[model samples]
Target: MSSAKVWTIAETSGRRLKPVSYELPARGRMLADKLGTRLASVVIGDQVDRNDLQELFWRGVDEIYLVTHPELAGFLVENYSNVLIALIKTYRPEIIIAAATTTGRTLMPHVAVRLPAGLTADCTELDIEEETGNLLQTRPAIGGNILATIKTPHHRPQMATVRPKSTKPLPRDESRSGLIHIVKFNPNWIDGRVKKVGMRQIEETGAGIQDTDVVIAGGKGLKKGENFSLLRELAMLLGGVVGASREAVDRGWISYPHQVGLSGKTVTPKLYLAAGISGAIQHLAGMKTAEVIVAVNSDPEAPIFKVADFGIVGDLFTVLPAFISRLKGGKAK
Candidate 1:
């Protein structure tokens, strides 16, 4: 019934969790489900605890491979590339899905060069063809306007790197179980160019935007950088994070890291509070998955209100202060 085996890359660090690591397995499972085949996942690193691998077993993986070596601890390009290439040469999977995170994006290009496989980056969707069993990788091209579908006819495994938070992680069932194979790895060929100098975790601040239940997102409508304070005040009052549309970042009103759009981070907060944003297509691509969207714009015809569950046709400057005061009063009670 199946023509090819699906493979996914796994990675783990602190409890913080790399956004792309979980995303790749979900994409792998989707392709496997369509192809009616077995899903396998491979992990590389020296100190990789089996906790993340055990979690993946429940997410539809039939076999889990671990290429462990002391030299492969914290994502060195050379060692990871070597291990992944070896696996590709030996196991010969039909489809390989890697997350488009910094590590995945970096290592994927290297692995592709060695394996000579066609690899697509930042893919939004992946599926297997019902008739030919070829992997169909879809990603945005030409500034998110064109959706390109890529296929590797000659390559053994079709490889892709998917953007984080683009797909839902498969439901974890603790009762489900699978096998873990510890592949013996020897650091014979890899030249030790970069030593593990040091490692530090970036502390998350002020209700991490990704983990927030509510987010007050501001756009260029605030008119000036100073006006962001109003949005920040409301966010602080609500105990939420502040997200910004791309236009706001381009206009130098906010940092690019805080920008939310096709080029930036994808967010799916429980309740999204949008203020002063006209909602361009790129911006919508990021937070369209939010559970509830509330748009506060002076213009009733703003595009953001179209996708919002609650639309308030009023100036955010006047609206936010009053809203914050009321929330503060409620808290005092």
Candidate 2:
């Protein structure tokens, strides 16, 4: 067997690769370099384009394990886990990481329980411990009030599912190269018990909060559900999406999909505007990576100001209307 390696699972939506697939290798590459091991990425799907798989090399993977079969078109836990277990047993990786998406969250746990290894979920950060060389996995704990770091000392393959958007993908390097090994599909891996019935796509209006470049987020300070209209108007003016803090979601001011925090979606927008959000650590964990942050809060001492590129210490109702008016080429009343 080859020396213990660091591995990242590439996530796909049909034939297209997801963004987190590249992001994982960027971080995994760093960990692999620090641990003196090679970084390998696994892609399992039917008819995934070779050009798309090549992006893994540009993102700093030393090898690409491509497993394809007609039955692998859609994700089924039973079949996917069977294939993954076989690879793990053969390669014997020292570390395994996947995105904390619906597929990853479900697959990793299934693989871990079968391998009987310790697994961490939704890690925001990962590092290598110098003294022991254990993979340090950091995640929010205790209702998102604190961060906890965990290690799998007894396990051969340390496993974790990292939250999407927690880290940015590395700049692509076309000169980088790696080996592509095609793993033969085993029909026996398919489970007779379960079958993929059909897939449904949910239609949504406008861009999703996670995909938008600019995000205007609200919090408890917005006062009521109707006040979210203020944020929607501003978002429309800015050509962005509206996001909300968990507090606002819990109060039924907004739907859960619009919520941004540790328990919610992690977003890396080009510009993030926080209107009336106090900036709890959990909320900060979600959008701290925004290229430019503008915060509006009445309190000068609000934590949001600390991370904001531009801070306005004033009421959101007053500040937001002024912003909307200016964007519309009209003077603030």
Candidate 3:
């Protein structure tokens, strides 16, 4: 029934497999099953840990292509893309999916250009067309206003990059069976144009924003940058992290990393508490997937309330402190 295989790129960071990497296998497995083909994953890095390999199998990867080279130890766009381009040429897979994280967003496009394949970015959903067996890539298009489904009918390897939190990983099964094949390639394929001469890793407290259980985000309603401390206090009390809207960052109230919106990061926390942010469509696009949304605004007609599960039409200055007091053993559930 199937002619070829469904492939996904498994990415690692900080020397461990990123959570988003597992998400690819979860999504790729479903499509592979529909096409009656096996799901294979390719990981490119200098080091491949044994534990990480087993973790991929647990997530339902049937085979692993270990693409490694001394030059790939550091992420150079040219080197990484060349390795994948070679792999794609050799395997000629039917479909290729990757995580929509920074690495994947940068890497896939380079490979696509070399292979001259049709590629889509930031896809929220993926499916297989029963009649044509085409890879149906669905994503938010045109300023996140409409959902668009794109198909690469003419491309040999249908390619797509999936948003990190859009899908969940399959449960890990230690008993799952699979194989790891080390891939060898010519080191001369690399062209040293861009180089990573220096790097700094800032430690962000709490779990990652996308994966956090609770997120406390502020916006223009805060009135001033200094007020972010109020948010930080509440975040610490709640065992959560602080998030911000584009306006807050634009006003120099917070750093860019904490921003949440279409122009920023997409987050899917279990509980999202928004303060002073008048739910712009762009802001909503980033956090709409959160399981539970709580909004606090001075205006009852604020757009954030339209999507929030619970809303308080009042001043965030008062509401935030009150919540902090109540949670700090005062008397508020």
Candidate 4:
């Protein structure tokens, strides 16, 4: 007898697959295996990028379910939800994971209501229980003071919208391979309650933070908004994005989109370099998954060091400039 299926819904930005989309297979493989099932992915768009899918094969996905339609070319919440709901009904996957992005935050809820299934949001980690095979969903809660583990004890096709940068995408191995199953999509399948009449661009938080390999974040220790220029310059030198602790954002030192904490964007970067941050729990909840964390704070006892891979007890104003200078020197070479 086949066990339940595991599926991940992939996301795209500017027609390119988002980094978190690529990172999901690593987790999918684990969950699927724990359930003794196969792992698959779903790509839904108006015009799916066929070429970029080779990386998914290397990531150990057993199959890629490609659903393309002219209507899906642009994101209409109703249309996307309709299509996903169709796939869920057809394939009957036991678990579905989506990125906790604007689209996902909106889309998943719609589908969940229709499926009448339980859905969890902003999960930082996922595991399967050895005893009951239930999905173990973990995240920071209560102002990030507690790490909560939740499960949908009675729901079928358990759904979760995970915070971006929470898990590493499986590494690519050309030796691995998979099948791409094209789902025939029909435009008339949707009710058309929502329409993408015109497009406007509004700023959102943490671009490079959500997808980049490196992130340079600042805190109140930066002193003022103007001081963020140092962090920006360093980000430029390092080819990374600039992030802010909630303190910096509240102080008007940076915008809310740049905040990294329980209330801000969660990040999974290869390197997260934080300066002047005291390492509050809310902040750690957002970025404790960074492959490497380097914290620089004047106070050696700052809580950030508890989770940091490297620490420097020093004044950030002095430390950041020196770091930027060193990066610039290396770049010049």
Query: Top TM-score: which candidate number?
Result: 3
Q: Rank all candidate structures by their lDDT, best first, as comma-separated numbers.
A: 2, 3, 4, 1
Would you give me the overall lDDT of model 2?
0.87
Q: lDDT values of the candidates?
A: 0.77, 0.87, 0.85, 0.83
Of candidate 4, the 10-residue stretch with the lowest lDDT total is 199-208
Better of 1 and 4 by TM-score: 4
Cα lDDT of candidate 1 equals 0.77
Say which candidate scores most in lDDT. Answer: 2
Candidate achieving higher TM-score, 1 or 3: 3
* Deviation of model 2 at 157, angstroms: 0.5
Q: Each model's TM-score, in the order given?
A: 0.79, 0.82, 0.91, 0.86
If candidate 2 were superposed on the true structure by all CA atoms, what would the RMSD be? 3.8
What tens-digit string does per-residue lDDT give for candidate 1 at 7-119? 88876554323545565677787778888777888877666756777777777677878777666667778878878888777777888888766778898889887878889
Determine which window of 10 residues in candidate 1 has minimal summed lDDT: 199-208
Model 2 residue 210 distance off true place after TM-score fit, in angstroms: 4.7
Give lDDT tens digits, candidate 4, residues 202-305: 36335556767789999978888998889889888888899989999999888877889888888877899999999988899888878899999999999999
* Candidate 3 wrong stretches, greater than 4 Å: 1-4, 203-208, 211-213, 237-239, 325-333
Ranking by TM-score: 3, 4, 2, 1
